[model samples]
Target: MSIKIENLTHIYMPGSPFEKRALDEVSIDIQDGEFVALIGHTGSGKSTLIQHINGLLKPSSGKIIIDNVDITGDKVKLSDIRKKVGLVFQYPEYQLFEETIEKDIAFGPKNLGLDEAEISKRVIKAMNMVGLDYESYKDKSPFDLSGGQKRRVAIAGVVAMEPKVLILDEPTAGLDPKGRDEILDKIKDLRKEYNMTIILVSHSMEDVAKVATRILVMHQGKCILDGTPKEVFKEVEVLEKVGLAVPQVTYLAKKLKQKGFNISEDIFTIEEAKYEILKLLKGANNND
Candidate 1:
């Protein structure tokens, strides 16, 4: 859904000695069903910002509006906000606790007070969304599944909620390349099938470049850049200074550009890079 954050600021501890402002009057408007990648260095308030979207952490100052409703106000129910905006924390596998895969996925629907049939339907749908088979794996113990399976089951828990906005915080962290690709692909499919807003908090610039339609760059609790990946990543020095890397291909293209290759340097994905390089090669052939 649409999210409006106007002059938002989050102070970690208001009166305590350790008081620190995590978000500094940040303001932005995110359209519905947009794929947004939020990135920054350690302690850059990226996590704090997503937490505010779902009302996990209330803003010390400013208002948050989701779907035209003021979710940050005192009267808004946190549960309602959470239902519409699902926040899947880093390493969701650590959150799995139910005995069976079915129960684990059903946990969210059960919490929502859905009836037996409805919960069963949601469980099956969510399980399938994560590439889990219901008939074969439903009764199996979640603990017995492989690391990837367990992670999928955990994601199923959030999918069952069918939230309008899905916020994933470092979802692929600590996983092998294959596992990371699997999770990222699932997210891409979920966005396409469900048409829901996707917010990705990640450290991998390549991964973000692959899926994000818009990028939000944070530094020291303030947003420094917000734009398309091509636009944001074109500036290499600022990102490097902030402890972030551009996609490898983008960096390679930038280096080529610096060397007077006359190449388009703003490509974000390998496929795009391949096409651009091939086009340039064809142009050289024509000239020769």
Candidate 2:
């Protein structure tokens, strides 16, 4: 599913004294099967913009076209759009309420009126997609699991819905390093397996740099930058101006380059930085 937003603007409490603009004439195009990472500081319209994508919120003055249909228009069914676009909120594990893990994951498919056999199949598939073994965790209480396991279950619930477009808002917000990697790896695997269009709203520049095929930077209710991670993170000064920081490795690489080291300033990950340093060392040894 491709998504196109044209002149999209959204406001809260439109005629009231406390009315505020949350999205300001933001326009962007998201192609099918693209992994887009949306980044911004708090109050930058990141949350507000995504809500419009799945019909949770309407545009105040523009149009949102999903798969060539203008979803913002009155004739469009919001429910239908929602079924195609699944959103997993931050700390989604807190919302789990089923007696068993399988039931929690089966909830969405069950709600869709899928047959018993199909719903069970979907629940198992979804759990497996998130690295959970159906036989091990099926009958366990969600609240009794670890933080990361609970989160995976929560994500599996959304995955079972089989949305073409999956949007996650801070999926790894409170996870430990290992837990974070698990969630991110599952996301990567899901994209490859299903060819789903993924829009991830994240605060960790390191996480986005590692996984995002494209990055969208927002500032004060507007989309200020959009490009590949390399392209977007290269503008360190601009990002800093908006109270956002690029990955620490990118910063280290930039400083090293400025100090006359033979290193690439565009590096975004620890692995990349390590490779560049090793290359520089090899060059030095050759000259010696």
Candidate 3:
């Protein structure tokens, strides 16, 4: 499903001494099947903005249109909107409580009142999507799994809901490097395999550059930048001013360029940097 936010504004503690504008006339359009990453430092309004997408929070002013429907309309059911847009918050494993993995993953589908057969189908499918084998993990306690496995189970719970759009906030927070990579791979696979529009709120520029098709930079309650990864990371000065930076590899590439190397500084990934450096070495060898 597509999402369109127009002039959205949200205020916290209105009329109080702590009144703050969490979102300020922010606007964005996310098309279906796009992996959009939302990046910003703390207090940049990234968290607050995702909460408004599925109606968890209401906009103080402006409109939210999902799939051409005005979700901000008074008569629209927030519950329905939520089903179409599943949100997995940071450290979702902390929310797990079921005795067995299957039960935990089945919670959302069961809440929808599906019959036993359909619920089983959805549970198995969701587990498979997250790389969990239903035959082995179905009866295992969620708490018994490794950290990465537990996270996958949490994400499977949302996947069972069959949402058209998925929003993940810091999905890899607090995990070791290996675990983080596994989760990111699962997220990438989910988007391609299910064609779900995904909005990821992240702090890691390397992760964003690796997977995000587009990036939206949020700062001081406004969306300061919006474009593909290549486009957004090009604004190194603006991002640094907001306490953000491009991928580490991008900075390294810039340093090489300053040394008079025949390499492009626009490189965003380690793989790209390696390729460019190898090509430059090949040219040097030919001249020798």
Task: Report lDDT (CA) for all predictions.
Answer: 0.90, 0.93, 0.94
For each of the candidates, give the backbone clash count. Answer: 0, 0, 0
Clashing pairs in 1: none
RMSD of each: 1.7, 1.2, 1.1
**TM-score-superior candidate, 1 or 2:** 2
- For candidate 2, what is the lDDT? 0.93
User: Per-residue alpha-carbon lDDT of model 3 for 150-174, expressed as tens digits?
Assistant: 9999999999998999999999888
- What stretches of model 1 exceed 4 Å from their correct place? 260-262, 280-288
- What candidate 2 gets wrong by more than 4 Å, as runs, is none
What lDDT tens digits, residue by residue, belong to model 1 across residues 1-288? 899999999998789999999999999999998999999988999999999998988889999999999988878898988999998998888899888999888889899988999999898888888898899999999899878788888888998999999999998888888988898899999999889999999999989988999999999989999999988997788999888889999878888899988888888888889998998899999999
Candidate 3 global Cα RMSD: 1.1
Q: If ranked by lDDT, best first, what sequence of candidates would result? A: 3, 2, 1
Against the correct fold, how does model 3 do in TM-score? 0.97
